[model samples]
Target chain A: MKRNPLVPIVVAAIIAVMLFAGIHSARKNRAARSPSVSGQVHGKDAPDFELQSLEGKNIKLSDFRGKAVLLNFWATWCGPCKIEMPWFVELQKEYGPQGFQIVGVAMDDSSTEDITKFVREMGINYPVLLGKEEVGQSYGGVNALPTSFFIDRDGKLVAREFGLQSRSVFVDHIKEALNQGQPVQAQK
Target chain B: MKRLFLCSLVLLAAAALGQDAPTMKPVVSMAPAPLTTITQGKASQVPLAFRVIRGYHINSNQPKSEFLIPTALKIGATTDIIIGGTDYPEGHDMSFAFAPDEKLNVYTGDFQVDVSVRPLRSVLPGKYMLRGNLKYQACDNAACYPPKQLPVSFEVKIAKAAPAPRKNPAQSPHSHK
Candidate 1:
């Protein structure tokens, strides 16, 4: 007995449909599981929060309301964070008088003493805050370390960087934030 | 009829015998072996060491552009010791499919990166965390794997520097030329 030639074609179509459904479901699942803060947070007000610094002093984001702020989230365990720490320190020293400030939120689970020791070892001059998971979630759930948010003087969020940023990149963003009051062309 | 059947059976047997046979197993094994080691020293200066498994090779710090495997040492921070700069062994030329346009640099076998930690004269003593990334690609004669960024973490004990050594120990023999 010979089988109908159309049987193979029907089987192939059913297999194709099954594959399409499987892929569609997988894409949806991935979208659901992916972190929400992976992309740029441009054109929105930077979320504000308060945390204690390594020195046990209270640090509030609104305290520097009229100044350009660089909110950097880092961890002692993250390699990229260490690389950019010195650069941030240099920028703070170079542009401090121009209404610029850098706040570092450390995601380290270590005690404040340990964090303070690390900051001193790295020679970080910026304020280092102890980051909590709840605070991180409020700021869009950071998935990677060294995520930085650039806030302008008007309290507008300007830019964000996810990984190691060159000194020039930070400098340029700081300059832009400082010049937000002036009528300047937007340069991204 | 019996003779005809016997002759046909003999022809079939001869045809089967003429076919090619599988080759014997070679004597050498090519799988890479696992590597692990521990070294301890003053927080200011800790000796970094690595052991390579037999049969496999890791790319050196300065691998060719085509090869992505980079050997690195991740050192945890110690009290006042400031650790900076990584020194690695040189690597040889290698090839990969991902970047077919270029030849990659890689090391074959075991390698190590020595890090120097300079502690301030009046710094406190304690354990600190030092972390870094090692980007590399593992490959054999037949194929090369994608570049991988392996996170490395190791501990260093902070202590007073040993008195001026009979052997100016600061001079690293494996210094990168």
Candidate 2:
């Protein structure tokens, strides 16, 4: 018996449609699971991690509980990182006394000596800690240098800045986090 | 009807082939064999496909940002073989926290790099292993880590060409001379 001449083309179309639907749904599911936190949102909890500090001490995110945290992921070789380091130092100085802390996670492969030298040269006054691949993964995977996550006193991820944002942007986010501070007694 | 049946068969074969492609391992690794064979004395194309660990991506041959290190492939120098220019796949566009809003060209998952490998006519017949490396800076959505070079060892098997047909001295055009 002879089959329809258009049968193959019709079958191919059906297969293609099915495949497209399957792939699209899979991608949608993945996206729903890890909605890239590319914007500022107040309800999300900041993923906590612990890493070695330059002083050879283990620093955990939970340790900074009840304090507004400005987490900056940077590298010594990043030029834009240098541009923002001094500003970060200044921000830490301005906000440290007010229940605010700046944590610098150096995503570098350089020896401690080199990182230390760069930190000193840049006059980075905040807690400079070493970062690892897993640490980046916890925060939904940071793909760029100088990415910062602003966490309120309650550990809520208030906002995220991917690249080198303006100082005012940093200040504005910090203000939001500070305003979201805990009860007056917790501020002490 | 026969033509339609043939086309359907081809599509099914292609679909199965796609499903059979190997997946990326946890750590960066290279494919076992070149996609195409390398023949001696002739210019043959060899496909070098590197599997980047899942969820992580390396910048394309030309990263958008100057500070980012582009992924590079290099084959070791060998007198027995001549390595020609390489062809890299177009990078997928993805944004990072560092360059918010600006998409960076990168390669994630399994990507193939096609290059020309010419085995010198004089090279002996056997397996020739050439050393190479893929220099890349891996990053996720969160941060970019230090650049790492994954050493690549390419194995090319060369088969000697068939010996020229011998003339019965009587059949040789030069037999008269």
The numbered model that scores best in lDDT is 2
Once superposed on the true structure, which residue ranges of model 2 sit more than 4 Å away at CA?
A: A1-41, A183-188, B1-123, B126-131, B138-177
Candidate 1 residue lDDT tens string, A47-157: 778899888898888777778899988765444466678788889998887778899998765678877887898899889899988887877776555678888876677
DockQ of each: 0.02, 0.07
User: Which 10 consecutive residues of model 1 chain B have the lowest summed lDDT?
Assistant: B21-30
Give model 2's DockQ, 2 decimals: 0.07
The list of candidate 1 runs beyond 4 A from truth reads A1-40, A181-188, B1-177
Going through the candidates in order, what fraction of the true interface contacts does each contain? 0.00, 0.07
Q: Per-candidate RMSD vs. true structure?
A: 19.5, 12.1
Model 1: lDDT to the true structure: 0.61
